[model samples]
Target: MTVSFGDAGVVDVLDDEDKSDEAKEEVDSRDEEKTEKGVLESELSGEPYIFDYDSFRVEWKVVSHWEGACNVSVSLTNKSDETIHNWNLSFLSEDEIINPYNARITSEGSDGNKWTFKNLEYNQDIRSGESIQFGFQINYGERIDIPFSYSIDSSEKKVSDSDYEISDQIISSWDGGAVGELHIVNNKDTAIEDWTVTVRTDAVFLTVWGGNIKKVSEDTYEFSCPDYCQNIAPGQTAVIGYQLSGHDTSIEILGLKEWGNKDNTISGNSISDNSVSNNTISENSVSNNSVSDNSVSENKPVTYIESDGHQHIFIDSDEYELLEEGIYLLDVYSDSMTGYINYENEDQNDSDNENYNEIKVESVKLEICDVFDETIWEGDILSDDGFETWSAKDTGFVLGANKLIFDVIFSDDTALKEELIIINREASNIKNTFIELTDEDDDNIYDYYEKYFGTDPDKKDTDGDGLEDGVELFLLDTDPTDDDTDDDGIKDGDEDEDGDGLNILKEYELGTSDLSDDCDLDELSDDYEVNVLGTDPTFADTDFDKITDKEEIDLGLDPLNPDSDGDGIIDGDETITREVSKDYNGEAIDKVSVNIGCKGSMENKLFISKASDKSGILHDTAGLIGDFYDIECDADFETADIVFSYDESMLGDTDESDLRLIWYNEETREFVLLEDSVVDTENNTVSYTTTHFSDWGVVDGKAYEEAFDTPNTPGMSGTDNPYMNNDKFKCCDIA
Candidate 1:
């Protein structure tokens, strides 16, 4: 089947053979005819059919058509001042829509004549003066009916300013600035449309957000909701904030008006002509009807000023003394100054002068310059007590000469300038003057220095270390507030000055100098004797062991411990006898001599002693000639030769060559003989080379069988003993 479309609203459906010939003739005949319908006239001329509404306009066009279906393009333009979001366009037509793009068919009439199309996510918002287009195909019986009498609907509900309740609040305030927020609340049952608020203020705006701002006049500003926040739903508030300079200025709400409707407005309160001091705002000053100032204080005394046409600005008086022309002297401690600009205007009510209203001072600035004429500091001065004051808290004046300049500008664009030279005195002169006048503790250290060094001015010795605060800080080069300057647990006054034998306290007590190393004429210094050797500095021999501390240290012995090697013999005695022994019932026995050849420091002294009776190892062996000796050293060593002295009477029937040295292995619970054992007949000692230290004893090699046959040793039972088979004695390896 084939179809043909003509400009005269004619569509003919025919078979394929007659379509080409009949459609050409029908179109040619329709071109010469005219239709009274507006859609038909527009389609014939290939122009769009336009439909106008109060808020938006629509244009419908038929691009192409066939026998039963036609492609149509429609564009929507928002004509109102407010933006339209999530909008729906509805129109009455006799065609059915299909294959829509950039739009969704939301609902259709029962007869399919009325259709409503909603916007897609990407094209939902149609801002003012902006247009969006969409296309779709429509099917008709014989002719396409272009959509007309269209209407655009959105979430926006048009309402007058009376539908909202406006309120202004100061969010925060600082020294010279403040932040304010305006809350526009919708009181109606539906969402409120675009709203604009007119505000009058003398404060300079720094930043604004959540709305659009338009400067209507010098002191009037219009704030309107942006597209995102235009539609304020019921019981919801649209908030906007602005940061502004001038803390003392008042912000007044003049009116609240609807967008695109100038006549529909809610008139606010008249601006207050009264002036308030101390950053106060009057009641009913913002808006009289619904808007209110929620944060400011109420019912303050207002001042009325009679105005003249001209304004005169000048300096009242100079605060600092003038040393020369254009030169003044300012104290180093004076960080701020006042009384530079005149606070009140002089009376100028003269008949010859025109009666003009007085203009207010808009702003004041203070700038400080160095000797080189370069601006060192510049800032705005805030009005306080009717006078403009500036503080130099952040950047203080440099010591020496400086230039101070002030500039005052009035609201009428007239300005006045004043200049003066300021000389800041040197800091040392101020310090000396303060020191001579203030000393609380009478310690000769001034209160000024005490505060500077973080010390207590009322205390002679801050740390109570027996030294004055001044002496500790100046003479001793120590912290005045801390007793232990080096944190070594010693007070400052008790510390040694020159590695001397006497501390400052002792030197003062004895009337001796603290610089001497040995106050008692001893060879040892105080630091070495007391700290290093752990000995008394006043006495020559600390341990009373017949050996001086210096002599003991020179001979590689500990002065604090009389028995340096843990043997029964004293260090002084051991040096002469060349032997160490263990005490048995207060008598020396089991004497031993050790020759350590190692490559490490001996942190602990070498010790040698007979094993106690509580030892679990079996000791009653026939081959053992002497008590088992426990020898140890808390040091790392590769090898050492230990000689164990044995009584000759205990050898009974055993030859000197038959003597052998053996060691008990703790891990294996076995006693093994040393292969490199030497018997010294002259010294009656049995010696052996050992790489490590453990229990050792002298034994007769000829009675090795009797020693190995002994049983019931700890960790040695039955076949568990390594020497149970009675093989040749083997050397035990000790690590």
Candidate 2:
């Protein structure tokens, strides 16, 4: 059949069924068509029909209709393997179409309801196996109906087969080769018992899946679908895939054959002579490959900044200036490192606005070393939001021309490395930089020096004595400028003036006065404070626990922390062990007195729980000894040595294994067992090394009653007991 527009040339659409089956088979053997109308036709057809023109397919549907207005949608597909360019579409309709848009088409001059449309710039080209679509509203006189038929211009002739068609499409491409699929459609009405398709290309097939290989060659291969697809039904398609190697981007479908029809060849071309008109097949454009390099190398972009003055930040840029070689000092605390990137486009106007690529900081590596590569500081710089920070104060720097190398990695797989010479010149200034006088007195010396001695504001020493200042004034209570303010023949430093058995120099070191026997005045003499009690002499109450230090010592309480046990009880109010067996309940039982001695730097500050207060302590109730005692010691003692002295009389034939020490963890609220306890049976004592002291108690609850007996203390009723006062441990001692 021949269809023609008024000025356009005639278009020949052959109706293959009109020809004899033998003649149709001979015509289909010459060329294998690239189009697959079965897929597009099946998508459009509510019913099936014989396909006569396999080159192109079109369908239109009325989306909506009212009294005078109707909406319609159209679809046009290139069933041929060749790309369609500058294509035109025409269709005969009874209704007048209006407001046409979307997939570009020109319908300016219509011919009596015979609407003719031509492709616009954007929709002009349609690649093989692709489709284009457009829609328009039509003003109809009455009811709306589907279009009777549609046609596309076949100005450019493409090779096709009448019996069947085969289309090869490249699915993906890489550096070397590509992977693709070949689609075969059976155009004949009869079932195809078996079929074969030959593909010829510049690249050789490395592997093929989902198809059975009928023949194989260096640059050509023939494959057929598996058993399920051996007998292809009319209008059905069979798909096969293969991976090819080499740089060739062209794929050609040479020939196709079906069962029981020797002369019915889809394409008559032999494998050697079959080649499509040189179409470049690629997954994506070769120029738009997205692979990038991520290796780190020394020869990369870098930046350097000077550290002589107050500036402390170093950053990377395309046009960065290098600093002059010099020895300079830099404040490490003020140092900062930053990195950025510049993205430019030639099409963009040259204004202040800049295009910045989305770049991320992957990692940052830095190293500081002398010329000998002796690493002073080698580590990774902390990175956040594409910036890094590092300081010399944090690394405890050295004082030389240190070589600092910074290596940074960005998300784009690019790296930047910079090396600089940094010299720390003012290392000594760091100590005195934060120090100031803080002198309260008018004297040249600071107040701290005057407090320890009696210095005159006019002269270095009063009384013109040979000895300077405090030896006579504060240390000995004698006038320093005077030869001898004291009428005694001996100088103050030479006399035991305080009569505490310590001479003047020893008293000064001991912070005692020559005139006063007791400086703290807590009824403890200066000698006792320095030698026996080990309490501070300057303050009357060393721990500042309201009660005088002397009273705490007399009560056998720790004079330092008010809440020694950390059970919310002060040591002063905590029950004391006065002759272990002497019970407060007016009951004296057979019990052995055990004296536990502590020997460590923290011995004087350690909290010891007496057996009398153990059973009645509860964590939440007032006037109750908490389950765990708080053992707070001076931080100086990393570990403490404790020895428990008990004889056979105390144990009463109890095995040593029954006696063990356990520690309580306040955070975990559980008791942890201690190991490696040394027992010296001959010395009648057991010792344990305590790395830390919280609440420690001997295991085997029987040890408490077995060694000594006392009446059970009543539980706390939220009322204060005469013996256990919560007021003493309220943490209000200092205030």
Candidate 3:
């Protein structure tokens, strides 16, 4: 009897002596057993185990099955637009795999249920829409269970050195050591995983973080990702910091490699084999089987031959010529006019060639196309001098990579086609170009602008002022020919044109505009906001107080402190004021006169009372004529005048000349005598002018010092007057 498995879960049985029913019953029993063993009916009927992923896909199938062992075949297909290299396939299975072909086992689980396989050298690269296959024999005791869940990872092609950019920033430096961070960015569309960066430097690393480090050579160190971060996605960046025991050391990135994919796992249930329509199995043969040679051979120099069995006519030995078969970088602005390819036919020595000596060029045509293969420029090249040189100066190439095709016809009716690829970059990449013209000083400024601005084309800085001519004329909008455009003694680089306390050079370093004092327009000068107030000049409100800095300062408030007075009210929501009053012997004088002078409106009332706390008094001999006056108001006052009229009995034995008005300093916790007080002896009044109000009173200067044993200063003890310790205070002899 013969059993065959067909497509769409179809099974055929062949038997003799009319035993078809028994064979069908046996097959049914086998199916029931597989179902009981947790195997899906679709999987037993030759269905491939499909693992779908974003970048690639994997298909696993059982080609032939026997009682105890079966042959399993696997195929990896690239689904993305990029080619995959250095691929690895991993899965979890209970069966034992033996006699594996086409792939090598890299790792296995301790219980022998897990496996990881890597590609052979020849099959390592799988181009887009292409698939590679490998197979192995699976031995199982009970039933064969296919690995439905699997993962396929692929390391991308080794990117060119130009695709990676490294930037170093010095975070801090001391006398014998320096700390810096290296920022590595992937400019290309390829993610890098488990990458290693090598740098050549003289400094010895004292400490490192964000990456693992190893010394490769005497002056070289290699850095790789730690456990935390292991990959840098396309157009993404990674930072590695290190502290080294050296100063002014030259550290450069020697090279970087091993670009890979970190997240390539196929999760959840197994995907259907819809993509395996053409993946059919034979009864006794494996499909798409391939084996890899483990031996490695040294690479030899490639010798390129033309299609006509002749040597190339063009040469690529000169830096000014571009006749190679590889990609080249060209500056569109600086190298467009002078780019040319030199033609020298080394095959001219062939005696069989009849027109060797008279190999005159018939016609040459050039065509330029974009990445989409759309023709952008096409023209004919006129060469009356026998085509010694060819140029595409008038092609008008666009930015990015472009394809160039050259079709030439010789006088002997021989036709040839030459191809080249050019990448058009900006003027800053001029060093990679074949030739640069017009800018004699190489300052990135065209000669036309230099002449128009009256600057020397031979010198980068025409005025010898340490600023580039192009930067002065274009960036800073300053005169390039003169060092000082404003005739200010300071040079343009040193002058603070916007009065922001930052010079032009400093502004350029910080990427700030030198012409705007308040770049953010937050109603505050950039100088005061950045240096004095420690606020962000680029932000309108640093504290988010809903008030501008200038308004807060104009209102006599701290811009940094939202609630200036610690009164639980923001400065923008409330008004602050001060008031002073006069009293005699702890009583408000009925004849007291008060005058307030200030700007703006006042809507709140004022309160005047005798201060109950008299701890601010510093002079013991100076007797208080009246209790300290505590005044409060809600309107900020510019000036206030108060007069206290008292009867002659209030003076007692103390003469009028012995009286002095004093104020308590809240911040310093000391007493300050008002030296500018005016006393009217006949009017029996003492008047004083003040800008702010707090505590005020009159004290006699001719009293005994021993009358008080305790200091009157707040937060002090003993008989020592806090003001007496400071030489700035004079509290005696008012008469």
In candidate 3, list every pair of residues with a backbone clash.
Answer: 615-712
Per-residue accuracy of model 3 over 1-735 as CA lDDT, tens digit each: 233332222333434425666775675556545432324333464545444566666666676778788887777778898756567777766667886665788755433455778765335556687776677888877566555455666553455787888888888886435778889898878656556788887555644555656676656787765322445778888877776654335588777876454433333222232222222222222133322121011111111212322224342323323523334556535423323334434555576777678875666777765433446667776455446555444444444445565666656544455555555545343332222238889776866445434578999998877788878765766666667665568887898878889888776766667879988776677777767888777776566555556655656667678777899976656644323343444342334555665433232335666665744443332566755666666665667787666666756787786556776676765566665578787887778876777776776644423223335644545536644455444333222
Clash counts per candidate, in order, are 0, 14, 1
TM-score of candidate 3 against the unseen true structure: 0.25
Candidates sorted on lDDT, descending? 3, 1, 2
Q: Give the alpha carbon lDDT tens digit for every residue of 622-666 in model 1.
A: 467757778888655567788877667656788888888777776
Model 1 clash pairs are: none
- TM-score, one value per model: 0.27, 0.18, 0.25
Each model's lDDT comes to 0.58, 0.46, 0.58
RMSD of each: 32.3, 35.9, 26.4
How far is 650's C-alpha from truth in model 1 (Å)? Answer: 96
lDDT of 3 at 212: 55
**Candidate maximizing TM-score:** 1
